[model samples]
Target: MTPPLAVDIDGTLTRQDKSIDPRVFDVLRAWADEAPVIIATGKAFPYPVGLCEFLGIPLRAIAENGGVVYVEEAGEVVYNGDPDAAWAVAEAFEQEGYDLGWGPADMVNRWRETEVAVSLDRPGDRLRELAAREGQEVVDTGYAYHVKSPSVNKGTGLVSAADGLGLDPEEFVAVGDSENDAEVFTVAGESFAVANADEHARAAADHVLDASFADGFLAVAESFGIATQ
Candidate 1:
C-alpha cells in the first residue's frame, strides 16, 4: 500500500520567492490517488485549503504550523492552539515597539487564526522573551517567528488529522525543511529532510536527501516507489 504524506510548503515545495514548483503538482496528484497528501505549513488557513483545491486533492491540510488542521474528506476542522494566547503575544510585541513587521497591510498573517507570525527581520531573541512573558513559545519556521501555545505543533496536528482520516499517525511519512518541521519528524513513521533543511530539522529526520526543494520531495516519493526523482 502507498503511504500517506505530511509535507511542508515553503522551503520544501516552494522556491525562495514562495512560488510552488509546478512539477510537484502532478506528482502530488499521483500520490493522492493511493493515500492522503496533506499540505502542512506555517502559512495561514486559506492557503492550504486553496492549494488543496488547486491540487485536486480531497485529503486537505494542516496550516499555521499545526495550529489549524482541516481534513476536508472527513469534514473535520481541528484547532489545537489557543487563539487568545496568540493574541496576547502579539499584543506584547506591539507594546515592546516591535510590529509584526509585515508592513501596514501584513497580508502574511491576515487570515491567521491561532498564531501570530512575525517577520524574520525582527529581533528573535526579544520576541521569544515577549512570548515567554505571555506564557507562550516562539518557534522559528525559517520563514518567520511564530508566537503560539507550546502544546500545539505539527506532531499533534498530525495525530488529530490522522484520526480524522481514520489512519494511524505513525503510518505517515513526513517531509520538511525547517525548525518548525522538527516535531513532525518524531510522529511520522519516517521523516525526510530536504538538503536545504535547517540544522534542527536535519537532525530530527531519518533521512536527509541530497536534493533540495521539490526535487527532494520527488526523491522521497521515488524512494517509496511512488514517483520519479
Candidate 2:
C-alpha cells in the first residue's frame, strides 16, 4: 500500500483567499482513493473536520498544531500538553498587554480542549520567551500564534495518527509551507515544501515544488506517481 500523505491545510491546500480551490478538493478525493490523506494543520480541530466532511472524505486530522488528533471513526484524542496550562499562558499574555485575539466566535479558542490559539501583534521572539518560561511552546502559523505544551507538535501528532491507522511513521510523506512544519519534515520519511514556503520549510523539505498551494500538492502527487484521477 502507498504510505499515507500528511498535508498541512492552511497555506498548503488553500488558495490565497483561504478557501479550498475546487481543483484541490478534486485532487484530494482522487488521492484519498489511493491512500489516506491525513491533514496535519495548525487550525483548530473542528475546522479540518468540517472541511473533510464538506469534501465528503473520511481523512484523519491533526489539529492545534499537534495538540489534538482525530481519526474518522475513533473520535478525538489529546496528543500532548495540558489545555488548562495553554489557556493560562494565553491569559498571561493577554494581561501583559499583548493583544491575544481569539478566532472568530464560531471557531475554536483558548477555551478548547487541546491548544490556545490567538492572534497577536507582539514579536514572535517575545511570545517564544513567554511560552518557554511556562514550559509551553509557541507556534507561528503565519496567520495566528498557537500556545501548547512543549511536547506536542505536528510531527508527534502525525506519528500518532499514522500509528492509529496501522501505518508506520517512516512510510508517510509530509508537505507544508511554514516554519511550524519543520518538525514534520524531520519526522516523515520524505517531505515537500511549496514554492511559497518559508526558508526554514524549504531547507527542511527533501524537495521544493515550483507551484504553490493545491497546485504544489498536485505536483508532489504527480512526482510520486500517485494517480490523481
Candidate 3:
C-alpha cells in the first residue's frame, strides 16, 4: 500500500520568504503521483489549494492547526475542534490590555522583545515585542497578533486530516521547523527537521537537514525512497 505523507510548508519545503526551490516541485509532484500526499500546515487560507493543484492530488488538508480540515473530494471544510473559547479568551485579553494583533488565519503572534503581560490596552507594537520576547507564544500567521484556539494546533490537525482520508496517522512522515510542528513530528512515522528549524523542532525530529528548505526537502524525499535526489 502507498504510504501517506504529511508535509509542512514554512521553513521545511519553502524558504523564510516562502520561496520554493525548483527541485521541490519535481520531487513533490513525483511523490504525489506515487502516493497520497497531504498538506498539514498552519495556513488556513486557500494557499494549500495551490499546493494540491501543484501536486495533482485530491486528498485533504489540515489548516490553521486542526481548526479547519479541507477535503478535496467533498469540496468542503470541517472544524475538527471548537476554538471559540480560545478565540474568546484571546479577544478578552486583547480587550483587557493586550497589544495582540490577529493573524491572517486567526493565529496569535508576539514579538521577541516585549513583556509577557496580557493586557487589553497594550499597544499593538508593544504586543509584538512581547511576542518576540516570549518567542514561542502563539503568534499570528503573518505579521498579525491573532491567537488561535488553545487546543487548535498542527499536530491535532494532522491527526484529523489523516483520519478524514481514512489513513492511519502513524503511517505519515512529516517535516517541519517551528514550535507548531513539534507535535506533528512526534506523531509521524518519520520526521525531519530542517537546518534552520528552532530548538524544539530539531529535538522532536528523527533527522536534521544539513540544508535549509528546498535542499532539505529534496534530501528528505531522497531519504524516503522518493524519486528526487
lDDT tens readout by residue for model 2, 1-229: 5567899987898797888767777777777878888888888777778888887889588888788887765555756768877777777777887766543472547335677777756666777777777888887777777888878889998888887888887788999999889889999999999988888899999999999987898788787677655
Model 2 clash pairs? none
Give a tens-digit lDDT track for model 3, residues 1-229: 4467788776777866777666687777777876777777666546676777866777567666656777665566777543444344445556666534343542323221111213333354544443334332454333223345455567777777777667767888888777667888888888888888888888989988898876787787887688775
Descending-TM-score candidate ranking: 1, 2, 3
Name the regions of candidate 3 deviating beyond 4 angstroms: 73-76, 81-83, 86-146
Worst 10 residues of 3 by lDDT: 108-117
Q: Where does model 2 exceed 4 Å of error?
A: 73-76, 102-111, 226-229
Alpha carbon lDDT of each predicted model: 0.89, 0.80, 0.64
What is the overall TM-score of model 3 with all chains considered together? Answer: 0.74
Return the top candidate by lDDT: 1
Model 1 steric clash pairs = none
Model 3: residue 29 alpha-carbon error in angstroms: 1.4
User: Model 1, poorest ten-residue lDDT window?
Assistant: 220-229
lDDT of 3 at 122: 39
